[model samples]
Target: MPTSSSSPPTDSPTTGGHRFHALRVVIPALIILVWLAGAGIGGPYFGKVSEVSSNDSTAFLPTSAEATTVQNRLPDFLGEDAIPAIVLITSQQKLDSADLADIRTLAQDLAGLPEVAGAVSPPIPSEDGLAVQIFVPLDADSEVDAAVEALRAELAATLPGGLTSYVTGPAGFAGDLVEAFGGIDGLLLLVAVIAVFLILVVVYRSPLLPIIVLVTSTFALCVALLTVWWLAKAGIVLLSGQTQGILFILVIGAATDYALLYVSRYRETLRDHDTRWAATKAAWRGSIAAITASGGTVIAGLLCLLLSDLQSNRSLGPIASIGIVFAMASALTLLPSLLMAFGRSAFWPRRPQPIGDDVDPQVAHLPARGVWARLPRYVARHARPIWIVVTLALLAGTLGLTQLEAKGVPQSDLVLGSSEARDGQAALGQHFPGGSGSPAYVIADEGELQDVTDALLGTEGVASVAVTAADSPSGTAPVTADGVQPIGPPGTPAPDPTVDDGDVLLQATLAYPADSAAAEDVIRQLRSDLGDRAAIGGPTATDLDSNNASIRDRTLIIPIVLLVILVILMLLLRAVVAPVLLIGTVVLSFAATLGISALVFDHVFDLPGADPAVPLFGFVFLVALGIDYNIFLMTRVREEALHHGAREGMNRGLAITGGVITSAGLVLAATFAALAVIPIMFLLQLAFIVAFGVLIDTLLVRSVLVPALGHELGRHLWWPSRRIAAASDPAPAAVRADTADR
Candidate 1:
């Protein structure tokens, strides 16, 4: 007769079912809000300012002894945004007095632009033989492209029929990018559609599947791009044309992959249970391990870019990481909900396989059974030998990784041309007696600057020397019989100007190609020989500086990422032994990936070594993805052990989860392979490395190596876990019972 008389029924739905029902609505709504905020609010947050500099002169001045010290440490110093733009000057005819007037007028107009640091045009011929050169300075903050466009517009408006004028340099390159955007975007879009269509069709074997994937992918990608654009506006990241060109394809490719993995599983489970809620739960349970693992891998790889020497590379990591994470969440939340909503119809008109045909009854009551059910039992039967063979093979492949070198040609090898920059490079070589890819300035200012100039001029690799700070080029404009006569050729034999009296800018033209081995060697020698005279400055030196800086970044980042993943896995497993084995296997997968990549690049792709950054990139991807497989397999193994014992648990874990992880790996690998078809060499290498790594991680490491190790370890795999240790007796019984059901 107490208060218990009015108690409600003891049994309602399980707490888990209620929680799942609530999350099915709430979590998705929250995810949608996050998605919108990231896409809509984050898009314009980056690139709000072109450069950050103060009006204070000393703020721009180099005052600290640490300034020079830091400058010497890498390719260039931080806070030194002194990348000078070149305007390659060309003439259709000799400089007549009329043409000279037009050129000077245009130069003066260009000089007025905010970003024109300086421009110099060689003096008009003093004699009939004197050569002509022009140079102009531009605003420090404004990009070269805008200045070039303004000047081009001016030239079109004012230049008379007597001559033609054009500007090509960094500004010119920027100008060209703006002009070429339409064409590039069209090409990229075409490529993305074709690639996405092909990949989805191959994986799903249904036209509807591909269409569904594309629509969902496009929605997610638009959101990611919008987010990136907003982030750029916020000053959080920089969005360049290169970033834009790659974003759509990358997002589509990555998100479709995650969706494909999750949705495919949901379809299989739906066919089995014929209940949307049960299928959703089963697919989520089956795929959570794989999704978490692979997503972690991608995130780790992208984060590795943060250690890059190039500001562009560093910025890209966080930006790409955001998209990857968003895609992952969409796969986990949005995708699962969509699968629930679609019910059995998603696989329709293509009839789902009958439950009896696909289901293995022997293992159904045992809580784990499926093709994967047989794997652990087989591995345990021959665990010792299988482990020995895999370990030996992986160790043997590890040797090839040592031969992998990081070296490559300059980026000019990658940039497109008929591009004015490319044309200018070629024309400069033809017109200027010797090649002038870009001139490097070696200015030494220990006060006795004249001696430093002489020292540099005396160096063996030095081609020609000029001191521009003194005696700015001055000559009488050409004269005609009445008002003007035509001038000589653009770079004809010209009168030499005398050096300035005091401070001088030593412009040293090197005798080797800017990107050549010889040029790098000369740069190194100059640094060694120029002890106290002055410091070397120029594009070649800058190239070398950036290369070394990148190496430093790689050295720091790779180990740090590996360590981070190791710690993450250890925490997840709550066991030191599990993390250690997992890391070891991942390392082996990476080695195999690198060894195979070296073979492909050396023999298949055929370039000098791989890209300079490939090792860093490959390390990032391989370790990240490799750990993903480990996570999936281990999580299931732990789940199985909790209910069944160690041996049966290992078998059941593989049976239940193996197909899911393998499918995820295949889809992710396929997406990365899409990058290979890109014409760019760096992207191609990245594609091959990632695609191949995922394949190895899935087939060899996850399928064979992990199972072999798990079988060999038995209960010891989860050592120090009293729960696991206590439940060891029934593992073989569970394995046998699960197998009998099949």
Candidate 2:
């Protein structure tokens, strides 16, 4: 490296006066204290996240959807809106009179609870006489999970022996979803931190280094949570368990990835600089560009979700973007301060050797011996063959994309592992109409009520239809093509259908399971027949609308994200071809990840299907994160090419940036893998896809494929850039010899 002076600068610790030295120490301490205070204040917000967050799918459905329209009109016709929970009690043998009486008593007790809304239905017997089902109206505004737990506990305490019970319905499934995400606050964070820590220990082979990196990540997450929690509490944005979990993982992974880059640069600078101040300055100056650009790309990609119709996706865009911003800030500010405070001792026994003023900064980055060093030479020679083979292999991975199914998993399948709601759903389906508790809400004008009711009744999958009747003994009265059925003797009159603002409400019980594709099909068919005559909304319709919204979002957002990232790369690298090539490779690698993940999900895990948001989330994370490695490598390659020629620069940059980029990728993948501990299918699938995709990015694409392509393209990789175009020519003899020596 060229030295501007024979000694350290005046601002550096060694040459600075007492006052200047004091400034350096106090500044770093102040930065540390500020972060510590922020983290301390933010830590408690983790437990409080659930207070402002919701797992209700209907709450996030596209407002323009028919389901949302019907949902809005429901409360006006049906009094206060409520969620239905089916209490299913089954026995091996036929239920006797005493058994039925006990079940009714239990139902009465459940009805008396504060969680129950309006009136609870009388126990209805099944055709086999082996099962009794009770429909309980749960207060939708209250905590569904806690209410379900209370109901379950009550049943466990009072129900007679030989009777088995399950609470299943929209309310029950919602409860299950809340319980599944219960781990996000504690277990998910712990697992992700532990996983990243272990990987960091292996990568750095130092005790304190991993802890320092984790501290930065954790602090970033803490502050991000604090910001998001308040925003959610103020109703500025929606918060959900899924988005919160993603925020946790994204902050940790992104912060740590940026930290690794800084550390790598700092280590190099420390070897040639005498003072920690000098090292910190050089390192920060070197790594900040790449770190900020990487974070900005991720933020941009996440923000595209703002265009989504689903509230959950729109919320995630800003929430995760906030996380990325904090992550970058922590890495650039907090981590550097910590490193300055610790100095070289943070590395312990593995401390980098100081080379003093004689060290050549350009050559110091060359790995003495490693796969990274050797692989570059291999790529330089076999550029064409290696890239072609790697391209073909990645393409082969895409073949399984045909098996991928991302329409949407059933509500029961949302939670992985054992699900009481899923079990209850199955039991309820076996004993009664599959859609008993969760009925479809159809809103129509009073003039079209009969037409809409007849259409719903004629629908292939509808089991029963009823109109909301406030005057009836039950909340609803039976309806058919013949209009409302009589409630009593022949002389009694039928209950009048409740109407509000010229619109009436009708409930359709689907013969198929409420969340089944068959049920969704029924809703679609009804909408087609009814057209503007009525609107259909229910648990199934909410799910259907959410899925449709996700599909629309992914279709629109994917291309926009690609365009955003492509433009960012062009600006960052000042080259069109390099960004396009890098984008192509990452896109292929992402496809491969999805393809392989599909096979694993289908054949190994036997999962039902994926939520529509999986591919979109995976794409946002993998493509943005995967490009980070490219930025790290290409930035250095472009820097080296300015002096060393294209061939020499490609080899040198590949060899030099390889270790740090690989380590960064590993940390990111490991942190994302921790998402699997949450027991949510969406998180699990995303975990696998991103983790696997990142490895492919670091190991194969960045390590071999990009290098080979860059080598073959040579100086042309930086086309339209006058600087790189000039540097692509043959280097001087001395420069070639210096490169050869490394």
Give the per-residue lDDT of model 2 (tens digit) for 687-714. 9999999999999999999988887777
Residue 447's lDDT within candidate 1 is 53
- Candidate 2: segments with Cα more than 4 A from true spot: 2-12, 357-361, 488-490, 725-742
User: Model 1, which residues run further than 4 Å from truth?
Assistant: 1-120, 123-197, 205-216, 239-254, 264-310, 350-403, 416-427, 430-437, 474-504, 531-533, 725-742
**Poorest lDDT segment (10 consecutive residues) of candidate 2:** 2-11
Q: Per-candidate RMSD vs. true structure?
A: 8.6, 2.5
Q: Write the residue-wise lDDT of candidate 1 on 605-714 in tens digits.
A: 67555555677767776677667767777876787778767777677777766765676676567666755544555667777887888888888888888877876777
lDDT of 2 at 167: 89
Clashes of 1: 61
lDDT of each: 0.59, 0.88
Clashes per model (N, Cα, C within 3 A): 61, 2
Best of the candidates, TM-score: 2
